[model samples]
Target: MSMLGTKWKLHGNGKTIRPGHVVAPEERLAWPLTIGIGMQHVVAMFGATFLVPIITGMPPATTLLFSGIGTLLFLVITKGRVPSYLGSSFAFIAPILASQQQFGVPGALGGVVLAGVVLALVGAVVQKFGAEWINRTMPPIVTGAIVALIGLNLAPAAKANFDKAPVTALATLVTIILVSVLFRGILGRLSILAGVVVGYFTAMARGEVDYSKMDAASWIGLPHFQTPEFHLGVVGLFVPVVLVLVAENVGHVKSVAAMTGRNLDDVSGRALMADGVATVLAGFGGGSGTTTYAENIGVMAATKVYSTAAYWVAGIFAILLSFSPKFGELIATVPAGVLGGAATMLYGMIGVLGVKIWVQNKVNFSNPINLTTAAVALIIGIADYTWTIGELKFTGIALGSAAALVVYHGMKGLARWRGTVAEPETETAGLPPAVKSAMNSAAKRSGKKP
Candidate 1:
């Protein structure tokens, strides 16, 4: 068969491939290939998607159901132009736990709803003014610091779980690292799922697995949905989380744009609005706030398939699986230690990705303005710093993000006031030559001059 007739094509080191030959996001493959690829995405996202609900004591089935619903909603909002999977967000885990403690699950859901509203409002601003204003305000330094803070801020949670079952957690973490580092292609892409499976088996061997729930679970059932109760006090506690979500969504969109060699800045507002609406919908259903999954992005990077159609298939699959109580119970059987191991790796990767962003943007650390911004943001975020006034509280990732924006922009203003010619930001300088060449090629293909 000719290359064009084949269902799959390889773009290895020596192969000469044209940009036009690539499978773009809007294109579709045959059903069999699409289903298989979609399933791979499902596996890629499964570990982290379920982990958030598990951590926050939310119903896994409900979370799974809403994830599908949210992704579908997002696709519709973006007019199916963007390929993404919406999953429960880890950024809200701390806030959810705290809100639940103070105001019960319904009240927590209320706070989540309000946070979504806040995100939507921010999205409106992005839509009206364009993403450039946001870019100017946050920039690489601020966004990177906030991203790193997200990962670092979650370290204690991972440690707490690890402390419960050290051996199992360590085994899980090791297995993930080995798979990710040593394997190639799909296996490496699915490292987190592999780690979870290995860890679960390890836990089983250690007699840590509990089959009681799985055995008792029904074969099929609807998720138990809950109604949110609005509380003014709890809203203040959780509204700040929108800052982290904004930073996260912006980064994810930019990463996807880079990977696809397409400029998606045009839809930045729509993406944020979709995610915000998804979060609101999920909150109404007793699920965590949802965001685009980076795990799926890694899968796309590995497989070289960026089809939006595959995401539709994946969403449908998730929707079907969500009705299976047995599946939810099975996921619950995985020991906490196993989760800890995976979370540790995932969270650390998130932090490193922040640094990667800085490197990719060629953020100048030598500049006192950039240096001070990043320094203060990291410290505030990592330390979970907070300030309270009356019933309002600014803290955690929110505080860190605020600090980053204020510090960076403040420095920029001061510099301009002093009549100093700020250094022009340069393209990535430290990246490998081959990678840079590829980026240039992608830029050219996308009709952007490199």
Candidate 2:
């Protein structure tokens, strides 16, 4: 059992454990372990976390500062039920770039704040209907398709970076793979961190890194905070950014639930609210929007530790780190090629995780709607196609996801109206004996009957 799973113990004999009777441990995380695990969370999110500012032309330090503030606020709003480790959200990168080109930096932040509002609204909707509705409305087909779309949609942008900086990118990639595949124990766990370290040093030796500001910087100071100013000109751009971020928030919450062996219902709404509140706070702190990071979940799962306090420690350290201009400069100088190389595996893992989710959920595909929905979603999302309707231009995973939702549910609604699509037994019949056994075992472990 994972640490969190172990903490949630069934009081009676395991065979007859009743729902709502499980006991939670007094502490989800221990001390030294907490700081260490928190560091792991920090390292996991470092790469993509700073990318938002780099792309949007905001200071990297501002990104770090906001991420820390946002993360702390998210924890408070969620009543500390979720971890707080603020970082950059990739979902907002493209939109921030678009908004910047269209309306400048302030306009971009305005959009980001609006995106935060959209997330909060989504949370409100989820709260009203309840999480089971989200599951029922999403189903495996819809969520799975969206998950797949998430990675597929980003592939082209990654490839463009790779093409622009092949050698540096390859070095970063090789280092990441080396650490992941060749290293062991703590080293293995920190493969991405180690790879970035090695790649950064390598770049520095080649004069690719510029760290002249290290000597001119103060060791400690308060971060420069900027307030957000909104305008109507960029509302459209910001709204979509927020919608896409909401989709990402859904995925992140689901991932954490899977990691903790809890139902998605346990934390989805609270987590969404946390991310939304974090973004609002981040705006006040003069930083970018924040979201839950799946990487930290991976660390928690591996360490079997789930301590909000540990995340608090990590959050404090992040805030401290954010105040140093020299530190931000160092983080900024990391070779983009190295980032691209590391991203190849990182992004690919995200795609694979989507497939794993579908497998875990035992999504039925025999039905025409199920197969068609997943298939079309993967194609359109991965291929990066878009269409505009009136003032809205929908494309990428956002478009693919919207399309899948429409096709699957709309067809089902139509069937109810005209009697066509029906649930079929064979939709789930293809799983081999081994997979069924594994899934059944998982269900048992999770205290659920198959």
Candidate 3:
């Protein structure tokens, strides 16, 4: 079998490819079509990638450069089998910001590096035992709840962005929905990019866009890179984020598996390891922590293109664009409302994906154990509930994830203990003698032996 080429045979007119057919990782379309699809992935990732730097006070260009570098690295580590894009991780935002205030940017970088190391260690454990252990520890109910929690946790940020400019945000959201629902093939797949472009022009027409940044930006420039300074205290502060990263990566892999109809359990460890290494590399270069991007996953879902080659092309394009200050400025000029609108859709889909996982797995919600686990996880994650132990903190997705595991397992163990001694069959014992005799007689008559 070929590792990296078209697996499907063309029939009739080879020029026309059918809709809903996944273009596999090893496959390639004509260069022009492939490049356009790659560009769509870049556009899908742009908002979140730059937003991290804007929030954390890191240079946007550096973040973009590292995002590209990290994605390429991830592709290499996963053997180009996984179709994922590495983007700035919002999971590390709170911890990184807190570390920055306490220690400096270098210190925050140190913390990020440490977090990466922790994730790498976890990846090692995953590789050794395989994903089955993780699945058992975090079953569909728990994983589904945790995944849904990620989306619910980000709802406020999406809303805040929308509130900044409601009109443009609504327009962007509506345009995306219309294009996705009404259009077919590539046009439908490019809905996110189309929405952003439409919303951007709409914002510009309304004089909401600031042109000064773009005008002042030089056509060519290099990203400002910073070196990390290791501090034990700061490093310790960010380690908890590893949990969130693991949960996110696992969910991302599962989602992609469902989309691609491929079994990715074998590559789960490699994917996590890649993400960890990428995060460490990004931290070394003064970039935000990186994670598998759900935004791009949404694009893949819409486009039906799971080609790893497209991600490689997108990464190269991002790297090239990162050297252009003009390009960075142009991306920056995307209105907050437009970004928010896109985020709303992307995040909501991620949440729905968790629901999809539960549905696919046939999680029995009627079981009190399953219901309780999901309930507690959702409430804690959605509420942004937090806990502190000494200098370590657990909150939002991290806390929700931990809670789901502990609650589900604890309830299961308790239930097992309570039922250790199986009760005798009680149906006959509780039935009236006449009815029982009648049932026995009917059984004997039907079977000759009861």
Please give each candidate's TM-score.
0.85, 0.77, 0.75
lDDT of 1: 0.79
- Candidate 1 per-residue lDDT, tens place, 190-246, comes to 788888889989999999989998899999998868989987667545765776688
**Candidate 2 lDDT trough over 10 residues, lowest sum:** 20-29
Best by lDDT: 1
Off by over 4 Å in 3: 1-41, 47-58, 89-112, 226-265, 293-310, 420-450
Worst 10 residues of 3 by lDDT: 419-428
Candidate that would win on TM-score: 1
lDDT of each: 0.79, 0.65, 0.77
Ranking by TM-score: 1, 2, 3
Could you tell me which residue pairs clash in candidate 3? none
State in Å the error of residue 283, model 2: 4.0
Better of 1 and 3 by lDDT: 1
User: Residue 333 deviation, candidate 2, in Å?
Assistant: 0.8
C-alpha root-mean-square deviation, candidate 3:
7.6
Pairs of residues at least 3 apart in sequence or in different chains that clash in candidate 1: none
